[model samples]
Target: MNALETNGLSKEYTGNWGKRTKVSALNGLTIQVEHGQIYGFLGPNGAGKSTTIKLLLGLIAPTAGTGSLFGISIHDKRARERVGFLPEDPSFCAYLRADEFLDLCGKVLHMDREQRKKRIAETLQMVGLPDKATTRISQFSRGMLQRIGLAQALMNKPDLVVLDEPLNGLDPYGRKELKALLQVQKSQGKTVFFSSHILSDVQEMCDQVGILNRGQLVECGKLKEMLPVRNVRLKVSTMDMDTVNRLEPLVASMTREHHHWIIQLEGASRTDEVCAILRGHAQQSIEITRTTETLEEFFFRRIEENNLERGITRPEPIMAMAEA
Candidate 1:
């Protein structure tokens, strides 16, 4: 069975007392995530990414539709028994020490004293805060606070981890460490589902991704399959000007790199013809590399295309996470 599933999940909020403006936060969103994969939920501002997450975690009831975690209905408390979550913005007991706070989290999961002790130690170390266990939560830096939030989430050794904007407020090194930690979690057969504005990190970490826009899922599939090979390149030893001239028509762009010639082609279909000219006819030794459309590029183009088809004239503010 899939680790997570949502079918036609929707959420709408009624207007405030004075106004009759109902807002559709999420609309007919459907997705399935398999076990042990890092699924990146992506979207532009006000796209309902957080709303969908809240629905999936049972923090709020969906206005319509159903969802399940490991075959258990999301509405059932048992569904959350082995699930861990880190909210986009989390507040904690500022006076409690890091260890103390994690101990409380473990207690909520019904772990015994010894169990809590073991996990508090383990998770602190897992999040690179082993030395700060005795430090007060009020004293930690922003990055440190995020680390502790993650530590609390993992205290239960959950089977599935759901994170909203997990990469928010981390420095370069912190982001690197957290990405590595998430990969380690997947290596342990735990499923990871996270939303982030860091497209590069999501591209690196997620095997599966779902792009949400305007409260609906615009795209969802295996990352590799979703990004097609868009460009082909060949680097080779110096070629005769005549041979290069013969190849000029088929190549999109040609340049010299150090002592070699580097040529880029528009599509994978040109690989054979380009190679045939370089290797078979020209007899030049060549190196071939295919590049795909990057997640960032795809994201912008896809969202823009979606907007255009719907007659939205303005470009979207893709990186503004606060409104999403």
Candidate 2:
């Protein structure tokens, strides 16, 4: 059985007007995650990622459909006991020390004296906060708070760990440590469902990905399948428009400058065909080049498509996306 499953899951929020107005946060979304797999839930703002996570964790009720964890309904006590969650913003009592917070979590999980002590030690070390165990949460940085949150989530040693925006507000070193910790979880056979707007992180860590747009899942598949195939790109700088017109069919797309044509050819078949087509117009000089699309490119294209479909104006890239 899948570690987690959502069937026709949906959440609709009614406006104050009571005129039967509805906004579907999740619209008939269905997904399954196997044990020991790292699944990336990716999307831009307002894509229903948080809604899906909330529904799965039973923090909010689904308008239509059901979700199960470990073959049991999420609302069941058994299922809730086996799952862990860390929201995007993890806030707690600032007066409590990191260790104290984790102790509370263990106690809530019903761990006994020896069990709680041992688990807290191991979890603190795992999150690289063993030294900060006694430090007040108020003194901790945003990144440190996130680590403490992760440690608390792992206090019960859950089978499934769901983290929303795990890398948010983290520095390079902190992000690296978090990624390493996630790898350790994977090695331990724990299933991880992580949400992020950072495509590069998702590309690196996720085996499977699902992209949501405007409360609807626009794409879902294995990482390799979802990524654009690596292929050659040619920059055909020519002064002739007639030659560029002939080359359009052989290439995926082309951009025309005042006196040059930039053609992008994908895959070997198309590359060879494009070369041949360019050779036929020998009068026009053809510059054959090769380049592969990055995961960021694929992500942006998908986002642009979604934006265009909704007639939303595209804005400049977010700082994270641009840097990635």
Highest lDDT against the true fold, candidate: 1
Per-residue lDDT value at 172 in model 1: 92
Question: Per-residue CA lDDT of candidate 2, range 1-324, in tens?
Answer: 999999999999887775887787889999999899899998888889999998888888989998899999977768777888899898988999888888888888889989988998999898888899899999999989988889888888888999999888888887888888888888999999999988888888888888888888878878776766566656666636676777766767788767676777666567766777677777456676644456678777887898889897856669968898
**Model 1: per-residue Cα lDDT over 1-324, one tens digit each:** 999999999999889999999999998888999999999999987889889889989898999999999999999989988899999888889999999999899888899999999999999998889999999999998888899999998999999999998888888988999999999999999999999889999999999999988887878999998987899988988787777898899989999889888899997888888787777555658888989999999998898888777777765557765577
Ten contiguous residues minimizing lDDT sum, candidate 2: 283-292
Candidate lDDT values, in order:
0.91, 0.84
Q: TM-score of predicted model 1?
A: 0.87
Which RMSD values do the candidates have, in order? 4.0, 7.7
lDDT score of residue 222 within candidate 1: 99
Residue 269 in model 2: shift from native, Å? 4.7
